[model samples]
Target: MEFIDFFILAFSAVFLFLWWRTCFTKTKPKNLPPGPPGWPLVGNLFQVFLQRRHFIFLIPDLRKKYGPMFTMQMGQRTLVIITSPQLIHEALIQKGSAFASRPPDSPIRLVFSVGKCAVNSAEYGPLWRTLRRNFVTELMSPLRIKQCSWIREWAMENHMKRLQIENFEQGCVDVMEICRFTVCSILVCICFGAKLPETWIKDIDGVTKEVMLMTSPQLPDFLPILTPLFCKQMKKAKELRKRQLECLVPLIKNRRAYVEKGENPDSSMVSPVGAAYVDSLFGLEVPGRGHLNEEELVTLCSELFVAGIDTSTSVLQWAFLELVLNQEIQEKLYEEILEIVGKNGLITEDTVEKMSYLNAVVKETLRVHSPAHFTLAHAATEETELGGYKIPTNVNVEFYIEWMTEDPSLWKDPDVFRPERFLDGDGVNVDLTGTKGALKMLPFGAGRRTCPGLALGVLHVNLMLARMVQAFKWVPKPNEIPDPTETFAFTVVMKNPLKAVILPR
Candidate 1:
């Protein structure tokens, strides 16, 4: 009722409005995808960060409220999540060049990737193109794949031996651990051209796992001021890097020495596989980039090592779990394998190709449990329109591969484990490449930046699965069926590691 009281109230209201505008309200120039509103200073940061494990679950609800294409603000960054296959096709395929470049890495990622020299995180330009081309031509080409067949056979045999030991000693084997060890051993052979002792294989595996856990997106990544508070993680990352370098440097040095001495690097391996991946790198001459230095070489090898082991292991783990759950499907696959390669006959790279049911099972596994829920985030090179929404240059975009593949409209009984979908009926002869038109499924991503390791990954999965099935009958342990509950590692992984009984057929 007094003049001073009225004046004080007005002042308070004006101050509150100014604070809200400055901290909470994000200015929009024109058209941006619709999303949930947030509190002052921290927009959707806590909401998304706290529920990252169930982040994919939130998308469907968000899509229902804000359409297929929507935006979310994480601190200062704007993330555009694309759920529809059509929109994904538009951005990643039709307008791929406009969206191919990766965004700048978070501080943690930069440290892990060794200044972003790794192929996956490298920016789109001469450097990226050069590195990618080298990877494809020297390491992942069809000829190279065939040349690496000996490595595959040796690795598969070693895997079987390890599995047999585990099954004998424990009666129930941890499929996830043995699978990871086998893949890591194979990767070490491919990368370094040697059959490392089990201890060294494990040492490398531990380093890779640490890096994956450390480089995973964290709150400090979104809010840099909090990075100091997360000093433990940063220190751990540095230590992992040091351990990684220690594991890899010797191999690189030895290969370099072999090259200098004019000796064949492949001679060091258990089986000669033409040139090892490291040997190829030694000879690679990237245009404008020249020869890769020691640190760069270590970083690239680390990328390949982790990418190869993690993705394949995750897929195979899911494959085995699916087989354990669906015994009939497993029977069908084993029968098909028997028909293709007689019981006593060896299953080689060529033999595995002829087995259609095996291929279908692997395809189905990828469709149902795509290892990566999201591709590494891509940034628009310039202003673009996706799904009729304006996307500004440098806006971070992620294609929802898992969501697209599992869309009810795209495939029947999408939730059910049905390899037969790829074999016959409505889903018959589906193309996984997305090159035919829109991608029905993209476990390895799609477009120019599609995983360079696609061929290698498929070969590894098929061979591992086929051999395991042929060698043993796998079943869930008593009261311990393999649970398919998913968790986020660098890849989508089993929260509960698969435990199964293996019996010699």
Candidate 2:
């Protein structure tokens, strides 16, 4: 088929779906929560489109005026926004079994490569639950984390040593880029049972960042009619994705070659033992789980790399920014570490657990800048009541978590950077991972889909922060103010990356 002809066909298909949805499909949900008046056909699209930042921020403002729950329209989609923890709990935890299923997806199939991810993006079902079970059992078990202590220690030392060197000529290290590279490398090793060299990860981070930094929904994603239109961005994503697939595929093949040749080494380590997660799907066995096809394995790996790279990296960048911007806070934390470890001198998992002040710094950073700003689009599977309004089946819902975390009602001086709030009077309940509830500081997100990599992420942030503070003295340039502006993207980046003079103490 000619490109134009294919385009025409795809447009006709989606146009019909939209037309049918508008004319025949039930449009009204009598029980749905109230929303700002929307224009016909466009719904509330104009309001958000004109001023997305100010408009989304209006949700909590509306809640204060309207109520905790209210409906908002974005084009043809109906979104229910809930701010109250009580309501959020009811939906995500109480009625979770029913609503946990992800809403049907369109863009994910066309633009995203990680199709049908189990833990992060999978629909709530047997497949999703099964994958979660496997992850918890094989990867996230406490014993496994303890075994990976050496991995954490090694990554942290490299991050610190590398930054210490960068502290010389640059005066300021791009801690943000370094953080992303280290985390991506760590997760690759964990999932694939082998480590891609640091340089390999550093190489791919730039491409992946380009792919993520584009905030506009891919043309192929937004306008259903555009798929046949010879899209360049889609083509760009494909070319980049192919390069990534090429890099990852060889590693899988090599592991297979090694295992087949009876060169198997580690059994106790979950990774690269016999059938790594990569090996399972490649072999179509998945060990304890049933057959997961090649597509499934590739999808899982893509999700792993992206998730590990963005979340761990963003948190670390924020932690460093906070430390540099708040020098007194940094020194106090170093003193706390000194008080506990004294001559222990090692920032191990055990030592990090004792550094309560260090934990607070990370938590504070998370509150200020959530990684996935929208928290990975959630949806309702069936009609449900929320905040006294009945929501219809298959409607999309989003919690403006950025709004929720920053709302004046939920936090004291919500804008200020303060680590002391996280400190308990007894100083023992410093839940750095936030396995317990943190009403306002949900950078890793909340509920069932809360980041699966939370343990590793926490270890990365705290260890990196502790070591950086202990090893170096960071000072802002004499006349320049720290640029706190962050690039608004999938994960936030410093709009003007943090630049400061550093002296190895």
For every candidate in turn, the CA RMSD to the true structure comes to 5.9, 4.4
Candidate 2, superposed: residue stretches over 4 Å from native:
1-21, 52-66, 108-114, 211-230, 263-290, 425-440
TM-score of every candidate:
0.92, 0.85
Which window of 10 residues has the lowest lDDT sum in candidate 1?
A: 265-274
Count the clashes in each prediction.
Answer: 0, 1
- Local error of candidate 2 at 270, Å? 13
Estimate, for each residue in 1-505, the C-alpha lDDT of model 2 and write its tens digit.
9999976887677767666766687557687877788875447766776775734445656777767777776666677777666676667666765556675555534345455555776776666766676666555677767766666666676776777677676666777766666676666666666655666666656656664553245433333444555456556667766766666666666666665664545432334454355544454443345676444565676666766777777777777777778889978987887787763488777888888788878777877766755656677677777767776666777655676567677667778888887774312353323345544445665567666777767776787777777777777767887788766666666777666667766
Residue 154 of model 2: what lDDT? Answer: 65
* Residue 284 displacement in candidate 2 (angstroms): 6.8
Deviation in Å, model 1, residue 118 alpha carbon: 1.5
In candidate 2, position 71 carries an lDDT of 79
Best by lDDT: 1
